[model samples]
Target: MNWDDMRFLLAVAQAGSLKAAARSLGVDKTTVSRRLRALEAALGRQVVEVRGQGLNLTDFGRRLHRHAEVMRDEMQAVDALAGADTGGALGTVRLTAVPMVINQILVPALDDLRATAPGLRLELIAEARDLSLLRGEADIALRLARPTEGGQSVLARKLGDLDYAAYAVHGAAGEMPWIGYETRMSYLPQAAAIARSAAAEGATDISVNDAETLYRLVCAGHGKTLLPRIVGAAEPRLVELPYRHGALPKRELWLMLRRELRELERVRLVAQWIERTLAVRTSQAQPTRPPDHRDNGADP
Candidate 1:
């Protein structure tokens, strides 16, 4: 197989389509397609298969993809070393996390990052879905729970714990309706708890996927929902519900990154900035006690 064709394979594997690969490689679609065909002919095996508008890797292609990633990382390491000699971390670091963490936490503290590493550029992706680190979709990811994927090629570390609390409109009286995550998010303990409470009360639950939307609906006096204390503390109009803090749901914040990128000066700088920022934020929101506290009506 032509070593040069490996770049085409790696590009398509990461982008999931030939057109995207062509765009990344600064070539036309025909060039990418021809290169892929030549690669397949050389190996006498297919690397990728068409699936609707996208392409999926074959078993043989997947093996090649892994090798391609190692090559990419090694090249990046060399570039990083060369760049490091210039005296400051330079280049972009893509970070992914849920919207609440992005909007409520990190976005507010971006000035700190600029001051620490003015040459560093951060691309923040705010979504619930995990982007592939090995595929170079994101350089670092913040997860609410421990990540199950990535094996040895990824590094996982605990940043801090996020405490949850029930929030509703200030001075609001009576049992407000329950606002919660959609059914698809029931894996979240707080979401499941809200589902149970709403179901038992026979109250029609309002469901939303994003934390910012959920917080807005709750603040509008439409319903009560669980929010990370760090998020809830920002709004004075949204008051914490009567539920005991100890009984509320809490989740650990985890940082994940590709092991290959760990040594890059820019990647390491951004990772440390994230760690420091979250540590300060979590400490500000940590609850004082762990004793018995009863939920008045909002269980979560």
Candidate 2:
């Protein structure tokens, strides 16, 4: 009997109906019906019985399904072996990004990545510090700042812009405290912006080291804090506070990697995955100004 026809039987048996099987297989109901008929004709026995809205498998059908399950597993094994031999995504890639981006963005989309690149592994470093790609500390990195130190060996591409905005919990009462960052982080433009706003608002003395903390504090209604629009927009409980004038601070989202390892299959796979993930959010929220393309860290 044809294995392709057996595939249809497998789907029908698992799904319990021709319509459900067709939906699972991405084919029309008639196609599933036709395939099942062909399989029955080849085997010269009734395999499936349609009763009302459900389908029941005959004795032979159960036997056939067992064989089909074995075939499915064998096929998957062969495909995996072939993929590994032919440079499929395999091995580990160390990726680093800030806590908010790691928690709110990358972590959520990992299942999708795993489905596509089952052999690939990820080492996610969630920190505000920029890890050294040159020192082999990481295979790939998603940074809010453009790399100015890795020389020609490091390749940097602007993924998109991360727009910032002040946010407070929905319907939060008058003069919500301004949650600022820790003193050492004051050099960051985002921190400076918050300091200016807090000073003008007569300040509340709350401070934190990271953006994720700022996000959680704002969600808890402790106060308003500067947050990436991408993060703030996703929380329905938090609303973007109106700006007095102009735009909030914008950070450039840059993807950085060692030029030498850029072509490695696993590194390339993770890099593209990171780019695709950020693209969806960045595209939805347009930056006030286009990303700065001047310092791409390309070899001169």
Predicted structure with the largest TM-score when compared to the true one? 1
lDDT against the true structure, per candidate, is 0.79, 0.76
lDDT of 2 at 297: 32
Give the per-residue lDDT digits (tens) of candidate 2, residues 1-300: 778897788778767998888987789999999999999998899999978879989988998888776666456435434434355548777899889999988887788788777888789999888776644567678888877845555789888778897778776624686888888999888898888878777556678998888888888989888888777777778766655534578899888886666656777788878878777766765534322223443221
lDDT of 1 by residue, 1-300 (tens): 788898899889768999988987789999999999999999999999999989888999999888887786676556545545465548778899988889888998899888988788789999877776755678799999998856666899988778887777765524576788888889888887777766754344468877778877887889877889888767777766655323678898999997877877778888988988877887776554422223344332
Instruction: State how far residue 153 of model 1 sits from its true place (Å).
Output: 2.7
lDDT of model 1, residue 42: 98
Error (Å) of candidate 2 at residue 10 is 60
Backbone clashes in model 2, listed as residue pairs: none
**What clash pairs does model 1 have?**
none
Candidate 1 lDDT: 0.79
